[model samples]
Target chain A: MSVSVQREDFDVGLEYARFVAGRTDVGGVALFVGQVRAESGQVAAMTLEHYPGMTERQIDAIAAEARARWALDACRVIHRYGRLVPGDRIVLVMTAASHRQAALESCHFLIDWLKTKAPFWKYEESETGARWVEAKETDDQAAQRWRR
Target chain B: MKILYFAWLKTKTGLGEEDVPQLPAGVTNVGQLIDWLAGRGGGFAEAFANRGLVRAAVNQDYAQPDTPIRAGDEIAFFPPVTGGVG
Candidate 1:
């Protein structure tokens, strides 16, 4: 399990290469990258904020749960903080397992849980002015299905 | 205890954090603490006026209204998370 909450952006190619290097036991890999939405030019930029210590711990716990539920060879979560413009990468969830089922399901599970459970918040600087993005009910429903 | 605010809560309260003095009697949980803070009026009242919109964390862990709060604890108040992928 690996989790990182940082201000710097990550390269998807490098992350995928790192995931596959010297992993003879891994037969399947799943990777998901989340980018900031452009919102039809209404949103100019977004400032992502999170509890410094708690955000990392929470994402780690989510990754740990994915490992517990699936037969995963590896799992990694990378979420960003600070100001970012539209189309910037915001998060990455990667998982590899001996089977495709574990790889896909665990990857989905980590992202779903992170959507609602993580401590990070987004404040948008838009044409209308600045406001915090409200949590969506759809996101909650997405996470609800994964609950034990 | 150190009380912290984030996102809109920081903007609403106009403060990032504040060191709170020891609590008086009968205030043991987060709900009561919020009530006390709201009673201070002005921005505190406005920030916590709607209980449904606000969420709290005790010692960096997601907490409920009944969650216990003690001295030296680090409490934070903020809205629900909106930090995942699109």
Candidate 2:
């Protein structure tokens, strides 16, 4: 299990290779990458800020929950903070398991829970000015599905 | 106790973190601390003007409104999380 919150970008291929390397029990690998979108077309940049200590702790806890819920061989979560432009990668979630179902489901669970439970905030720079992004009710609803 | 702010809250308060030797009387929980912070006026009032918008954490963990607080505790306040798959 690994969780990293850093400003540096990561290579998907390298991470995936490292995750499954020497793990003969792994049969499936599920990976998800999130990138900054040009939502309004006017967004020039997006800055991500987080509570340093809390961000890592929360993400690690979430990963632990995923491991408990699924028989995952390995799980990796990488979230980048600092200024990013549209098309830049923002986050990555990868899970390896003995079966496809466990790998896929755990990957999904990690992303969903991280959405609302994590302490990161986003600020967007647009033509008008830079402003804090508002939390969407949709995100809350998405996270609610995991309660069961 | 240490109070920390993030994102816009930090910008508004002009402080990222501060050490409070003592919490005011009657401020024994996250909610009450917020109310007490508002009482400090100025940037604090503006930052916490909308209670629903502020989110709190106790010792780097997500904290509820009624979460108990005490001396030597590290408390953080910020806006709701906007992080998702992206």
Instruction: Assess the local accuracy of residue A136 in candidate 1 as a C-alpha lDDT between 0 and 100.
Output: 96
Candidate 2 residues B41-64, lDDT tens each? 999999999999999999999899
**lDDT for model 1:** 0.90
TM-score of each predicted structure versus truth: 0.97, 0.97
Instruction: Please list the residue runs of candidate 2 whose C-alpha ends up more than 4 Å from where it truly belongs after superposition.
Output: none
Across all models, the iRMS values in order are: 0.9, 1.2
Tell me, by DockQ, which candidate is best: 1
List, residue by residue over B1-84, the lDDT tens digit for candidate 1.
999999888888889999987975688999998999888888989999999999999988899999999988999999988965
Instruction: Report the lDDT tens digits of candidate 2 across residue range A1-148.
Output: 9999999999999998898888899999999999999976988998999889899999999999999999998999999999999999999999999999999988988898899999989999999899999999888887888887
Candidate 1: pairs in clash: none
